[model samples]
Target: MAVDVEAPGLTPVHRELSRAYVEWLTPQDRQPFRPHVTLMNKATVEEAKAALAELGAGWSAFDSHSPALLLWRYLGGPWESVRRFPFTGRAG
Candidate 1:
């Protein structure tokens, strides 16, 4: 689920936004952010490794767009969607 964040200004914008909530971030979150999308979680090591291998075998570069920003809150066991901020600007 590694991502190459190509969106212009995204990295800088993430840093700027993250700074405001630095006090709440964990040690891992405090480190440099490597943006990625998780396709599967809560899986066994073998299952995850197999899935990754299968996915990588058929993977190809693709272009995708972000239509909105989803704000989520981790409630211990599950994540809750707090808000959605739709991008009104023109897409690249």
Candidate 2:
């Protein structure tokens, strides 16, 4: 499965955080930092394309800001939410 890296959502802060995390993992298990939101896993390219097309018809883009980071751990199959790190920066 592959993820499509889009802009705005893939901000500078996220890139930095991803870089830090990838460094902790082996190159075989992890890859160079690529910003994207995972739509689905283990999907065929044709299926993904169809889904993207269908989704785009009714999709509306909106402004967003990263407020927190969620950490999840995979047990055997399902992932469990472990922690959340909220961004705490003063506005100028």
Candidate 3:
């Protein structure tokens, strides 16, 4: 399932965070992390298609705040929150 969304003003902050993770994190994923907010997961393909269709031609943007970076461990239950590292809001 896939939906495309944009963070109009966060390109810089995302680059900084991505670099920090790549440098300081012990193990990293090989896939270059593209910053996107997930819209659907664990849903059937048809369901995803229907949901995206329901958005009509397009959708309006909204305001949101990112206060923290969450760390999760998947222990069979899917997500177990291990930590919430609040964003320092510091530029790289």
Candidate 2 residue-wise lDDT, 1-92, digit = tens: 34445665446765666667865765644655566567777888899889988887887656556687788887889999999988677421
Q: lDDT per prediction? A: 0.77, 0.69, 0.69
Q: Find the number of clashing residue pairs for candidate 1.
A: 0
TM of each candidate vs. truth: 0.77, 0.60, 0.61
Q: Of the candidates numbered 1 and 2, which has the greater lDDT value?
A: 1
* Candidate number that wins on TM-score, 1 or 3: 1
- Separately for all candidates shown, the number of backbone clashes (residues 3 or more apart, or on different chains) is 0, 0, 0
Per-residue lDDT for 1-92 in model 1, tens only?
34355676567657876888888888977887777777776888898888889998897777788888899999999899999988777643
* Model 2 worst lDDT window (10 residues): 1-10
Q: Kindly report which residue pairs in candidate 2 clash with one another.
A: none
Give me the overall lDDT of model 1.
Answer: 0.77
Off by over 4 Å in 3: 2-28, 90-92
Model 3 reaches what TM-score against the true structure?
Answer: 0.61
| Per-residue accuracy of model 3 over 14-39 as CA lDDT, tens digit each | 56666777766544443554556778
Q: Is candidate 1 or candidate 2 better by TM-score?
A: 1
